[model samples]
Target: MKRFIALIFALSLFPLSAHACGADTDCALGDRTYRIQMPDTAGDKPAALIFAHGYKGSARGTMRNKSLAALAERLGVALVAPDAIMDDWSIPNAPGQSTSPDVDEIAYFDALKEALISKHNIDPDRIVVAGFSAGGMMVWNLLCARPDDYAGFIPIAGTFWAPEPTSCDTPAANIIHIHGTSDTIVPLTGRPIAETHQGDVNKTVAMYIANGGYSASDSPDMTPDLSCESWRSEQEATMTKCLHDGGHSFKADHIKAAWKTLMSGN
Candidate 1:
């Protein structure tokens, strides 16, 4: 009966699936909405990469990156891009215009996960969240505050905000932190802004490692575009840090490299 219905719909020259969103359309949910693009040949329950936009960036802006779209298609994964409430993630202690601290950011991600699984036919266990700069900070906070939510994290050139976290939760999943060695905007050692400070990126990763009890992998390996250091308990989890020789800039290639390194072991 299902096939018959689908055949009838197909014969009508219209796609059976309803309202699929891409670079041009928005997937509205609650008061928020995100944009998504699935690979042309995506398999059943294909993996997804939730790429958060950087500071003051929007979902439409993220979707407009053709390279990112191509990368997702080449990897055969769904690309999910979400927007911040006000051009900035309302993280507590993070510099933003919000008068009230955001408790919705976490909830928003939870909603996104549910939406992906129920609506998109994506693999629940293979969703990896990644971000650049301020969005990268959001990735860290998500992993730190909610360790059990996603399969992995990839944070590029960002870390915690002022009043650095003393600890993060356990059951820490895999992480691939990418950064630029010459970053002065969000330095490795971190820099101060007004009354707040950008927490050291190294310190943030170190805390996760110590808290998660991940052991270093014995042998070292390198990728084509970037140099990386790794730590892992292969039976359970992995944490890797990759660095390039650039400044506080970003490219889809950085996330592509991180995605390769993260999925290689899993």
Candidate 2:
């Protein structure tokens, strides 16, 4: 009896597994699912950053990226990584990845937003959405169509596909676009992927500027590794365009820097 009691005591010493629904566990809403990891340093009401994965990427993979997760932890924020459909977004006119009539990513995002606010208990006002490459283009679509859904937007290494959306809902949220000076994959000028050419970063930013009526800020970018310019609208929204010295890369540092600039107006 004493030996059995000792074994039970040893088991009890280890904390009970309440993590089935927590970090490392995938949370589902409808047919889609996402994973969330919270920072230990953040308070009870920490903000969230919903990061969309690149083409052929998964939420599990994004969550496993130590560099990105470390940045989220350092910022005292919750990191939410979402999965794309069939390893690629349902982009319009995207060759084999064309949008399905039944596939409504906007609807999925809408549900995810409400799920984050209600089920996940996140601060709706402090939520930001960001992505990389194809995911970055996804961010543009999300922010353009649902401007009020997130507090801020960050798109890295990608913009709209060719024949970009002519109009976007306004006033849009604060956005800080990050790219590389030597990016040949999704170059600053853009290149043909398969059947469609990528959208020009200048044109994409210009569309947002025209829609939001943002004014340029003469202040120089503070980060030495990046070249940045900023703009602001009367609605209190900020716009930023940033370029680094590398090529088609995903750096957590870049995301951190852009996040700071998006929050800090010129």
Cα lDDT, model 1, residue 37: 88
| lDDT (CA) per prediction | 0.82, 0.82
Candidate 1 per-residue lDDT over residues 6-82, each given as its tens digit: 98888778532236566578887688888888878888899999988888898898889888888899898999998
TM-score winner: 2
Error of 1 at 125 (Å): 1.2
What TM value does model 1 have? 0.87
- Model 2 whole-model lDDT (C-alpha atoms): 0.82
Q: Give the TM-score of candidate 2.
A: 0.88
How close is every model to the real structure, measured as TM-score? 0.87, 0.88
Clashes by residue pair, model 1: none
Candidates' RMSD to native: 5.8, 4.5
- Clash pairs for candidate 2: none
